[model samples]
Target chain A: MKIRELLTRWVGFVALGIRRTALRATHTARQRIRFSGLGVAVAIALLVMVTGLSVGLATSTTVYDDDIDYWIVPDSESPESPLVATDSPQFSSVHETNDRITAIDGVESSTPVLAQVLRVGTNESDEYVLIIGVINSPALEDVSGLNTDSLTPHDPYYGDGEYNGTWTGDAVLSEGTAELLAVTTNDSVTIAGNRSFTVTDIESQSSDVGNVPTALVQLSELQHVTGATTYDQADQFVVSTSSPAVRDDLEGIYPQSSVQSRGEMTASSTRNSDMALALAATALTVALVIGTLFVVTTSGLELVADRQQLAVLSAMGISVGSQIRLVGAQTLVLTGLGGIVGAVCGIGGIRLINAVAVRTITTEPIAVVSPWFVPYGTGVGLFVGLLSLPFLVVVTRRVTGGKLG
Target chain B: MAGSVASFDEASSSVVVSATDVTKRYTRGTEPGVLGRLLGRQSPPTVCAVDSASLEVRTEEIVGLAGPSGSGKSTLLHLLAGLERPTDGTVTFRGTDLASLSRRERTRHRLEHIGIVFQQFHLLDSLSARANVALPLVETGVGKRERRRRATDLLERVGLGDRITHRPRELSGGEQQRVAIARALITDPELVIADEPTGELDTEAGRTVLQEFERVAENRAVVLASHDRETLELCDRLLRLRDGSVVDQSPPGGSQ
Candidate 1:
């Protein structure tokens, strides 16, 4: 009963406060409230967008990393040479090394994928494409679904039974590469010094960067045509595991090579996108600071101006605490409501920025704007709330002076 | 009802306010300079706002406290209302010493038992007449429906039924003062203090306000401070002040 009564009283007070004031309390500075509310809203919305984008980016990379348990790279690796140099003969052969790592415990599946930046010319332009070599089996089948009915890697132009030992018959093209080359299944493409192979299936790869066309061939055939010494001699190895524990097993097996986890690779790929994070932080900080200052100054100044009225209320049974609440509640409602609205606009603003800037990052054709933006919006609103408190406390205490009739 | 406060001394069950030897002093100037302090000067010149004055009021009486401006009429009221601490005396209300009560206690007491109407009306400009009248119940934790009901009833009785939803600015002076009266009586406090309640109203409005005050004093004791003859005429007894001291105490309806 007491609780019910308290709620009722607070409701009445809130109603009174809201009705008496304009957007804020009569004691609150109007311009300050308007601008502060706007600022808080904007800041909150932007904060939500930034956090969502960051978390999404992290989640996408984490998914990729979790899929690939191990990476095998040359020991002396750097930005200059992502792969072992072509002239290095000993580095040119790695089939025995592949076999050695495949036999390890918890090795669910292993495939030798040769990734090289081979420039291909399309009707419109020429660009570099990554190529991989796969050993057709149930293990590689589980992760990539490359040899299954879904991708249809075994049809004509893709492969024949005898070509497992050779790269002569056909090859598979990655979805992106096939789209770029404007080629269909059964199309033929020349490769590796005049050797031609039929395009059997269009494959999709998580590792392939956006818009890059990829070529896949049987390892032995690629080694034969390109004059590569061994089946694993070409690019990097793609390893899939049923669980994360095999990552350590693969690392222990291939101790001499460097392994790039999915996270590290994606981070490296999206390094240029860090500007988004920085911009978000700066926007939130600027909005919160400016909004807080606007609200506090306006609220504080208005209370000072109406000191006499406050004194009268104080003298007429209005407690100092309730008086403070009366003022604080007004600030909260105005700014909090403003925050919700501003966050919505902030999201639209972000989309606008993205549309104008014209950058290709995600696989989607255009920007993916998140619809719900409460996390950032609430953050901005909370900051505004804190800012309004000091002014509220000071003003109420000063005016009431702990006096009553 | 008139001349009822003379029985304040003998009444054991109905005493509302009791102040004994209340004294308050202001210190001399203490400005930001060495010479001012060297001359024994403070920021403000030392003066007595209220000397040792002991007075009491009983239930169902209206006691008029008349004094010149700055003669501590307001100070003595503040002291009796538990708004200020006496430098050298004690004030008791209903057997509870005002000096002994905590801040919260005093506040609660003021909210539940004392109704004060000031000269300026002090109506919250944002609130309508009904909401303004319901404020004391906010402290009492009453439900909104009940509070509004009581407030509407009070406002209607005060001849403001048509203006219940109008804010203070929308109402005339008489209507606003009526709202103030409604606010003061909402809690049905035992003691009602009116400090120059009608000082700001026109003569007719002032008279109407006094009649409303008279209606409130039917059950509770009213301690009214005013120099206005009309306000004193409504009081049950007159306690006149000269130089911060009570100069005369006349019976109800008596000539000064």
Candidate 2:
């Protein structure tokens, strides 16, 4: 209770102090158009814009998965074995590489992932899609970055035609494609070359924007529709290792394939963060240099003009530090208010940008809301405020120096 | 009746202020100006504003220090008030040597014991008459309610009861000086120092202010430095100064 009372008193004093400063400031009316207030506002606006974009990009593109350590793809030079070299060079089978890689001692498990481009259609509409051939194991299904919660057999492709229990001629459509085709859980669908299928599941669009509404089909069914000669041919292999230390050991086993660790992917994300930080720093520097100068210079001149009044206050027992605090607090309050306004503007500006651009691709415009941006903007304003301290102390002492008579 | 008057002298034995050969030199550098630098006047040209000045005030004596503008009258009052340090001599207050005390000590002593009224009526413009009158007591740590009560009574005594809430700018010069007098006496200091306090008022207003000073000196010793002959006439004793030296004057109400 005592602590509560003390805190209450402290808050009251600060409020009174701020009010006094504001009222006193109005007495010096011609001082209203001070350049320092303008500088703080500009600094805050710039800080919000740069930090907001960086933070938004950081959150939007983040990937969270813990399943496979690396995905191995055939190197362009491998070019053989009758596996078509698509985006990643494909090889004949994962079993051929698995035995050689297992000899290296750290290889935990490796499986082939055959991927192909196909077109799927409902009676109402059709969309181009990427087909991933499922290896028919619960462990393979357990991989993250793949939404399994919505992968039911009653999605839009489940009806309008019969489907065999072996999942052959059966397909799945992601949530986006379902929305696009206005299709439901009992709908029937046809895939590449008019092979009919039932709608099984709709995955979440958040996993990957480019892969939204893409199909996941049985390996046999996928190979039949694409007319591939062998089901064992793989475009890539999802490799899981015992530890990060064994990545290089496995990369050596498949000399014809390129190996990349999850760390590399995480590193790419970190580079984006660093780039954002650098841009923010540059913008903050520019704002501070220009804005702080304006605030300091104007506040200094204002102090000089109020010398007599300040001396009067000092002689009446107000300390020099109190005088400086008064001025600093006054400036910070003004700048902080301006910063809040700037944040409002920044939010509006982001909405404007997304509206003008995002409507062409997606109906939903990006609303840049990030918790970290608030402090980032306030910190910029506070930095400019702290920069005004030295000027406050020097100018206060110079004005009130022992001359109240 | 004459024997009762003799007994009153014993009652007036309390020493309110005492100074001995107090000297204060102000180099033009100390005057806070750039001319001191251009002329190589690093120190204030070493002119003694108060040179070897000595005076004392008893409990109820109204002593007047009469001098021209630069004749060390105001500086001597400042020294007695402990507002400034004497360069060469000692001012002892109630058996304690004031020169030996720290700045904070001197400030405390001034706040508790000595009151000052400036020529310009140095009242805080932001404060009302009652607040200005209570200011010295406030600094002395008096309770707000008591300080206001005493300040209001004192304001009434100074003939400004109606103007208790009026700020300094709203009051006439004489009324402002009266308010300053009330402020000085609010802390009930032993000595009150007035520096040409009536200089800004007209003759009638000046006489009225001097009357208030006389009334205040009945309990506390009033040390006033003024060039006004009428003020000197009203004082218990007058000491003249010229060129930083005290000149002895005739007794009270002399033709000279």
Candidate 3:
């Protein structure tokens, strides 16, 4: 027979089989179908949630926000290596670089940032916190969600490399950090145990950075306090641009530096995280196995129970290929339903996980389910359903082997 | 019925199915003894289900296979239906030897030319009587509407027009058997095989089924396996089996 004709016959057989099986299940086999579907749903939900967490962790550790289009860091520093960004000994004249980058035609705004880990405390006790120093610029407003008005009422005067530059001892503390220090607006906090700055704002931490205690300070004040002003150096320059063409200009600014886009940074971070990838792969394999086993067991049992009916069909001249297609169709329907349910539950699971994290870890969300995961989960569920085909074919051949009597 | 048989003789040509020295053997158990196991060479125990049974069924003829339990009546039916391959000798349908066809080709031949009925009715419990009748046509790639129409007509012909929408469980034994018969004729096959088709029905229901079989046997060959004398009386001829072999042949009304 032609492929088209065979397919047409198989399709008709499967459609009728699915209808009959579904109807029969409603009366005699409801529990088996329900339990199998539930098993598939739970497996897919776990897979989706774990994948979301892996992606979320990767994004949080690398990209800080969606606003900054490009980051200019030392050529030796890679976004995949957070340690490279934080602990690298190389430094750049970020203020000058920012000034040069800001003058480019397509550049929207630019800022120089100095990030350091320092001991922060009250008069009695102290704890380690990440202190990020930023020059007051419009890019800070767009990238950091920082309230510039609270950091400094007037712009700093340190761009000219003047030691007598005006200093603003104003600081912004993350919500968790402020909670730990027990301070509010206008309260004085000690940075590195020497300089005391007044907390002008306490904002919730960005989910991108997780639950690390962090505070923002003026770049000039931080430079003066940390003694980074001998050559006027900063860690990296963050640049914002409406057009991607400015990447060429940013790259030409420094011969020894690399300019990276947000996507590149995310990919780099995910590629380097062996632990995250391993955990995600393990979760996926476990989910696939659990889901496939459930389908195999349930569908195998169904085939056994329906063996006589299959024999009858065979005796009535139905082909073995059509019988296999019948089972395949039934499996697809069951798993397809499970996939939809799982995707919905997984989205809710993401929310629930984030809610719990906020209470326990003080982070907004450590997991995020992207919109694409819906179709992805469904497709995986179907693949898992397809995995049960071998078991189904074996069972079918055994059952239909002239056992009609 | 006699006039229909005479008309079939005038219109039909050649035999629908012929079996010559057919034998079917089944292995009963695992091989015995240590040497047999080591050399992988033991016949074990075997039973010949059908031993050298030869028969011919022509169009318009209803051939009855009369035998006691375990007398290989069902086995012979299976061989004729191409559901099982004979261990020895040949079984041919319409001049084509069954052994010459591959497994897939045999299945296609059965789908296109053979229909079978089981004693248990074997109707899918999920579908209505009409849908059960239409089950065979699904493999033919017939359109849904046409299949339904033809199935409905077959059901009506079998006196099931009012019960067309009833599920198997909703109908009586006789009604369900009628539906099975309708299913058997759905493809308009050249041959129809039934294995104790009326074994589960009451006397009146069995009579109704036998009458329907006689009616349908006008244009097609039917080989039915039954131990019931009344049912056997409906066939144009009867072949009696004993110990897996045909022991006697009875003309119409000879056993009655």
Chain B structural similarity as TM-score, candidate 3: 0.91
Q: Rank the candidates by DockQ, best first.
A: 3, 1, 2
Residue pairs of candidate 2 with colliding backbone atoms: A36-A295, A157-A198, A157-A199, A158-A198, A158-A199, A174-A213, B27-B43, B27-B44, B28-B44
Report the candidate with higher TM-score, 2 versus 3.
3
Per-residue alpha-carbon lDDT of candidate 2 for residues A1-405, written as tens digits (9 for 90 to 100): 256543443443344346544544454242463345555676677666665555444433332235677766566555553356455446664445544654566656555556666677777777766566544333344322444333432222212222233444544565656676667665787777467777666655432223223556654466556654343455666666668777777667555766766545443433547776576567678867766776777767767876865654443343455556556776677666556655666666655655664445542233343444566666667677688778777878777635535
Q: Name every residue pair that clashes in candidate 3.
A: none
Report the C-alpha lDDT of model 1 over B1-256, residue by residue, as the tens digit.
Answer: 4457656545856888888887877666555478867987657656787877878788999998987897788888888887777878889998788999876677777888888888878887666789889988886788788898999999989999989988888888878888988998999999988889888899999999998988888879999999898888988888776666666778646656
On residues A96-124, what C-alpha lDDT tens digit does candidate 1 reach at each position? 55566667767766655554445554345
Per-residue C-alpha lDDT of model 3 across residues A143-177, encoded as one tens digit per residue: 35445556762237474657575667889887877
| Candidate 2 CAPRI grade | incorrect
Query: What ranking of all candidate models by TM-score puts the best one first?
Result: 3, 1, 2
| Runs with alpha carbons beyond 4 Å of true place in candidate 3 | A10-28, A52-59, A63-118, A128-165, A204-267, A289-305, A332-354, A360-364, A386-388, B1-12, B31-34, B37-42, B123-138, B141-179, B201-215, B227-234
lDDT accuracy of residue A80 in candidate 3: 43
Worst 10 residues of 2 chain B by lDDT: B135-144
Candidate-wise lDDT, in order? 0.67, 0.65, 0.80
Using Cα atoms, each model's DockQ against the true complex is 0.36, 0.08, 0.52
Poorest stretch of ten by lDDT in candidate 2 chain A: A154-163
